[model samples]
Target: MGIILEINGFKYFAPLSSFKPKHKRLCETIDFIKVGIYAVINLNNMFPAPLNLCKAVQIENIKNEHYRNLVRAKYRIIKQKTEQIVNNAKDVYNHKMINDGKSKLSQRCNDFRNLELKCKEYSDKKK
Candidate 1:
């Protein structure tokens, strides 16, 4: 529900996953970024999320101090890597499109082109 990245005119919302033991063994790649030990940003799992279908997280409403601070810290890291994330997502999308989803990376990624079409359909319905 965090990190809205716009790639190819569609807004993509990548999911942030808390670090698991499995993550410790996996090296961070272009599609994956580690935010300290707290979470991992999985660009491969990103999906188009139109603004109307998204809700803003109110940090102030987070009653737990530890959780609020963790969220803030995570956002700070995400902000600093915004450019890399954008570029990486674009590359991943292009790779998926150009290769017709045959590569391993493409297989790992969500069907971006299909999701974009779906996004357009949703937009047209709203109009």
Candidate 2:
């Protein structure tokens, strides 16, 4: 005799008999697909996102050595997708920062020139 449970609306049909190998295999497959999709979609690193999204990401971390290599293969694909997103974000942020810095510098230079001009006018008046 065994029991089943559900967490956060996700169903878990646990049966007795030591959980047959076939059942384990199926679960592994489900985990791989779910996690891969979540990781790739939320590439911004919004992991552990909403319950539904979490369920998907958690699938990638499923620890089952029996299918370790297979899971790793799927994970590699998701990793590449997420990494690309992260790189793109970094590039955008760097570009914006550079532009903002240039703008500030230009403004400062203009202000300095105006001050210099005003000083020259004062000197001319004194002369």
Candidate 3:
């Protein structure tokens, strides 16, 4: 014989042979000796495919999407920020060249136009 008790959502099970002869009060009890019997039978059919392969595909898809998005964002930020930095440097260089009389205004203007074309090409590629 066996007895099971559920008190405050916790279960306690004991063989009836263990309860002493002097103990008389049992608040509530049931007979459910083998709680794991059903689980033992159901576990064998739980996975139809190889568990490692299934998990590998799921993890790979998630990681691939995350890395793809991160790389694309990194490229765009680097491209745009680099273009801005180069344009600022070109402005300083143009000012210095003009003040030092090292290059004519036409040459500085041509360099600026080329920088603009490169920026436009980058923007077009992004679209």
The TM-score of candidate 3 is 0.18
Q: Which 10-residue window of candidate 1 scores lowest in summed lDDT?
A: 92-101
Candidate with maximal lDDT: 1
TM-scores, one per candidate: 0.92, 0.22, 0.18
lDDT of 2 by residue, 1-127 (tens): 1112232232222122223344434432211122332222211111111222122334446688655655565556545544443444343333433454365323222232233355456556666
Candidate 3 Cα RMSD (Å): 34.8
Candidate 2 deviant stretches above 4 angstroms: 1-38, 41-63, 66-71, 79-83, 95-127
Cα shift from native, residue 24, model 1 (Å): 1.6
RMSD to truth, every model: 1.3, 24.0, 34.8
Model 3 whole-model lDDT (C-alpha atoms): 0.31
Badly placed stretches (over 4 Å) of model 1 are none
Question: On residues 79-121, what C-alpha lDDT tens digit does candidate 3 reach at each position?
Answer: 4544443343344344533554454433332233334355456
List model 1 lDDT by residue over 30-61, tens digit each: 88888777889888899998888888889889
